[model samples]
Target chain A: MEFNLLAAFFATLTVATYFLTNIVYLRYRKTLLNPVLASTAILAIVLVMANVSYDTYMTGGSWVGTLLGPAVVALAIPLYKQRDLLFTNLIPVISGIVAGVTVGMASGVLFTQLFRFSEQLILTVLPKSLTTPVAMQVASNLGGIPSLAAVFVMVAGFTGYILGPSLLSWLHIDSAIGRGIGLGTSAHGMGTAKAFEYGQQEASMSSVAMTLSAVLGALLGPIAAWLLL
Target chain B: MKYIYTLLHILVIVGFYLMGEQLQDFFNIPLPGSIIGFLLLFTALMLKIYRLEWIESGAHFVLAFLPLYFIPATVGVIEYGKLFSGKGILLIPIVMASTFLAMASAGWVSQYAAKRKERSD
Candidate 1:
């Protein structure tokens, strides 16, 4: 009975907090205020202060996490919608994702090695640029902690969402496809959301790039793990 | 009635996910089942096996709450207190630099390709 009650309470808390932070994000339009980042921080702090264990919190939180698989499957809808544009720009789109995913994985391994992180930590960060669910899966397959992999994915997302625009502008990456692929490949879902601020084309391309990067990242993650670790 | 339709659509999407899982288990594939499900659904749509409207509303509903689904796992990071203390904080800069490099390289390559395509056209 207590488990059920706690489950309901934490589940409600998670949803309510997400909505509230989402409102704050919508109002401020700041990457730092991203709903995922804000809500994760809020919930983490609340749990820590209340002395709640991660296992206890997950009793309810897992219900929400279960939906992630379906949400990833749902990505097919947007990718389907953008099929025409994707094909028309196939050359740049494919090349950009290939380059970006390679560089994203390579750079992650390179930096983590330079910092002399543990092998497990290096594996965790290997799939950082992929979408959250895929990254977590890849991380686990590579013998890293899946939960920590999620955190690294978020860090990558936040980093790209915050710094991506200025970098794009400075680099004269003015084309919509270029901007979208750049952000999406580097940041995943958060980057796609940021890409929306540009225009429909950028948003569509970003979503496509985000999905494709997940596919490519999954295939490449193990290879990197083998080569680096 | 609308809610029923939405639920049914969601069921179909989830069904695809389960199918992907089964296939993965059977084949011992390296890819995640969710990704296999995504590809399966995308192919089904392309092949016109599933109409867009059938899954459109459900997909939208699910996608809207996508970020919410990630909270549980991300919050799990609190368990790794050691990773975030002291020198571990260096990860912030490391992540930032790599992300910048990725964005720059992708943008440059795609922009160059796009510009070249434009010139040829």
Candidate 2:
């Protein structure tokens, strides 16, 4: 059927584009050239050029999206693997993530309000610092558009990846844990990727921070919306 | 044989996700099912209810493609043309400034805590 063929084509296109972009990203190691960002931009342009509707593309794209749930559950593995470090640095880790989550949510709400964005936009921005899947979920839970939230999350990631290192050094935060927490809490996966450049300890710490922030961000998202918006 | 093993591992991970979804619907929990499954799996690992090896390869395989999973959602933004027009440009500065604030606060707090711990030790 035409439907099946179109679905298969779009799906293959998504995967192939991602595959190529990922290779480029790994080779060049530029934050701006992140595979997700590049592939999304590329695919968006291609779809528009082809005059393909979003729904039509999604018939295939949804197959890829379906894996996200299992991927999220798989997150527990890294969290568990890092359990020892997490416990050893429990106080600092917990305090850092809590502060980051609170500040991130509060600042987003404040700025959106200052700009006089709609309630929906405010909710979308509320979970901007969370990892993508979690942010999208939190956004929807707070009555925001999930896809819009995903865009906000990517913006947050890019912002943190670009500015985080300078901000950390300026603050004299030389500790691996500090750098890790800063990047991961503020940027999510992209931040964690940046943390890897710092060293093994920082990378692991960042991953833990990213995971914990996702959990904390989810719990706090609705509360922040209730209080601020 | 290896492929089968990987598929089986994926099935287990998916099973946990389904369980989480079921529990959420039954309890009317506000949390997303994936997160609930995340917590459940973490607890299971901590309690030794599931060995890491059983799920490690599958988890790695899935996580490796994690970024790929969200492309469709991001591409969905093409639908909302108004968001990126005019005043929407202002969102960049807002997001950047807020991200800096978050990075600064989290870094400062953790650095302070870590230094204090070092001194005490």
Candidate 3:
């Protein structure tokens, strides 16, 4: 009987928390605070207040997490829709993602050494530019912690999404595809979400960059570890 | 009828994912099953084996809720909360700076390349 009630609470809580986050975002549209950040904060606080264990929360949270695989597969639709534009700008798009991945990993090495961080921390930060799923996989492959990679990826994403526009304008990078690719390569899904706010073209380009960056990051992650570490 | 279509679409997607998993298990591919599934779907679309109408609704439905799927993992951060104290705090500045650099360089490179292409063309 107690288990059933907890199960019900867990099932309902994920949707409710997500809905509440959406409402907050809708009301505070000008703040540029994303639903993911807002909802995670609210949910974390709630769990702490209720004295719930992370394991208990995962019982329900994992259900929500299961959707990520399917959701990522669903991205094929947009990529299909934008196939023509993607082909037309293939060179720029590919190079941009390559540059981003290379620069992201290089900077990570530079900074980790500069700060004298542990090798484990360096491994975790190395894949921060990739999307969460790919980043996590790469981190694990490189002998780093997957969960820490997720946090690093999220931080990189939030930074890119929140500050990306200003940075783009300041750099005078005006091409929609360029801006979208940059944001997506750096921020992954969250950056793509922010790109959607700009226009359809930008959103599509961001998706392309996000997808390519994931593939490239995964392919190069181990190689980078071999070379750099 | 509409709901049936959506369900069928979802089944097709799941089928692709399973097929990709099978291939990966056999061939020892380095990439994930979902990515392989995504590529398979993209291929089918490109080859005209499946029309957009077949999966459009289901795909859009899943995409709409994509952000929610990430929350669980984000919450997983709590598991490692203790690890973030000493050396972890430095991650904030490092991640922020690298992200900025990645975005700026990517945008700059792509834009320059595009403009150069346009001028040459």
RMSD of each: 1.3, 1.1, 2.0
Tell me which of candidates 1 and 3 scores higher on DockQ: 1
lDDT of 1 by residue, A1-229 (tens): 9989999898999999999999998899886788888999999899999999999999999888888888899999999999999999999999999999999889998999998998888888888889999999999888988999899889889877777888899888999999999999999998998899999999998999999999999899998788877
What's the count of clashing pairs in each model shown? Answer: 0, 0, 0
Second chain alone, TM-score for each candidate: 0.95, 0.94, 0.93
TM-score for model 3? 0.93
Q: Which ten residues in a row have the lowest lDDT in candidate 3 chain A?
A: A30-39
| Model 1 global lDDT (CA atoms, 0 to 1) | 0.90
State every prediction's TM-score relative to the real structure. Answer: 0.97, 0.97, 0.93
Candidate 2 Cα deviation (angstroms), residue B30: 1.3
Q: What would the per-residue lDDT of candidate 3 be over residues B1-121, giving only the tens digit for each residue?
A: 9989988888777777787668867898877667778889999999999999999988888788777877877777777767677667888899999999999888888888898899999
Candidate 2 lDDT, A54-99, residue by residue in tens: 9999999998888888888999999999999999999999999999
Inter-residue clash pairs, candidate 1: none
Q: Give candidate 1's iRMS in Å, 1 decimal.
A: 0.9
* Clash pairs, model 3 backbone: none
